[model samples]
Target: MIVSGKLLVSLSLLVLVFKVSHGQPLVPALIIFGDSVADVGNNNNRTTLVKANFPPYGRDFVNHQPTGRFCNGKLATDFTAEYLGFTSYPPAFLSQEATGMGILTGVNFASAASGYYNWTAQLWGAISLDQQLNYYNEYQSIVVNMVGEAEANAIFSGAIHLLSAGTSDFIQNYYINPFLRGYTPDQFSEILMRSYSSFIQKLYGLGARRIGVTNLPPIGCLPASITLFGSGSNQWNIKLNQDAILFNNKLNNTSQTLQKSLPGLKLVVFDIYQPLLDMITNPSDNGFFESRRACCGTGTFETSVLCNSRSVGTCNNATGYVFWDGFHPSEAANEVLAGDLLAQGIDLIS
Candidate 1:
């Protein structure tokens, strides 16, 4: 009944390894689709500037090796798989580790800096949602070969599909690009929603039933956003934050409508906005000391490869910071967020 802290951690890791290495998982698998926030390592081999494959990035990960995650450690998707009884993190579909029975554990198709729009991925040469779907189609063939048709179909239908995109459409494109700057926030959100709906229906067609999609986190509070858009007036920052709220609202409504209209679909919008806002507004409440700066580089503008191994000012300790780089949450922050997500959306899959 009373387990020591060290022992508890040991037991948990052992159980996780067992679940990942053996037994039928609670959920057959998890397929992740998103931008940097949920990307594991799908961008590593791609000709993308939006990559995190070098040191200080995965400083706290297993073996202290960088695996292209935009964080100091495991992502929320990895933790979600842990809760779902996975022994190890899901492998990126493009990674060599994703072969054989490892494919049954799941695969991550999320590419950093990519988004709902194909142009978003093109901006950084990352994989677009369309490309991710194509990869999924290829994955289907792999699954059918590994297991019979009936079993493969059952695994896919029972599996949980996780999606998180759209942030880059606003952050990296609409807000900055002169061409996209013509559209109002509402108009841009609509465009993104059109893309989201298309992706969902496409997954549904591919036999996916349970899907968990994360809404945008508070973009205004991201260290990079604050550095790029923050000023004494704070007017521009307020506007971006408002756009995020508007986009999240539309996402909720669309998910609800789609779930009702699409047969056997269970689409749940994970509310990442509120919890992240809470952590930003009150960092101490979530065990974070630095809320507006990252642990790497200048803690303001550096992200992706910019927060490199040669970055002179990378912090010695990352646990007290909410962000690892200017653009992404630190491992500590990810753990808190992932715990909330698993609690909120567990029923949809389990």
Candidate 2:
């Protein structure tokens, strides 16, 4: 079957198109791991009080359906996938939808209230960091079975692994829990760093080279933090914010160190604190009407389950507020933060 030169070229192009279409999408995949900030709905299936699969949570999402996200709509990861041209948000690894091509594309292993430290998740009955890492290993095996080893390895190496955590460690564990009381703020930050560094190294070992880890947001400004520790001179809140800054700095340093130490690694530390602080401190500048309080309930004392359907005084306009609940950012705020992340960290993957 001898073919002419033009016919041969046309056949080659057709084969290329078929291979690409049947293979990975624009951005190979987006494998997410970390805490509530990255969790899509992993916590909903868990036996944890940290679940947010209820009304007023995903109120602003497509179809206004609450899909267990902690925010009023999409999370940063959801926007990230969309920005990278994914048709849908990465499904939770535990969800039934996370199978075949979905698993091949990406999966979210993060759990609400989880953190770098397992103890933080244990406190709230959420999936721990160790467990999430195990889930990634599970995902790798599934993808290999679906697409074969060589192609699966390519997707794994090219994928963007988004990790967001440390909030629960500081707010839900070290700050409030008396059980972990011995460590001072500085010592606690170091503790979290050790785990964080290990997590990145472990991911690299698992073939994740393109990684973007979100730093701690300004914890002092969160409505929940303000309500819990903003009384009196706000010394506790001040201390917490300072701790958060210090930890973020350390995280940045860790990224640099890991990049140098690990071969073919592209790790970026997303500075969420500055952008989020700007939105909270200068709400009008960010087109947000409310910064000091959330849109749910009284805006200062409600979060997670507390920001439920029966919660009175839930704001009609989630877009006008910085936070949807006392702790989580509104969907509008997530979009802004996601934009910042894409701008700052796209190079790492590209």
> Which residue pairs come into collision in candidate 1?
16-87, 20-87
What is the number of residue pairs that collide in model 1? 2
lDDT of 1 by residue, 1-350 (tens): 98896675556556655665676667888888889998888889988789888998898999999999999998888888887777788788998888878887689999998898889899889999999999999999999999989999998999999998988999998888999878899998999999999999999999999999999988988888887888754222877789999999999999988998999998889998889888888999998888877899889879987899899888999999988898898889889988778666745654
Per-residue accuracy of model 2 over 81-145 as CA lDDT, tens digit each: 87676777789998887876767778999999999888999889999998999989988988898
Candidate 1 local distance difference test against the native: 0.87
lDDT of each: 0.87, 0.86
- C-alpha TM-score for every candidate: 0.92, 0.91
RMSD of 1: 5.1
In model 1, the Cα lDDT at residue 318 comes to 94
lDDT of 2 at 279: 94
Off by over 4 Å in 2: 1-25, 232-236
lDDT of 2: 0.86
Off by over 4 Å in 1: 1-24, 232-236
Best by lDDT: 1
In model 2, what lDDT does residue 79 have? 82
What's the residue-level lDDT of 315 in candidate 2? 89
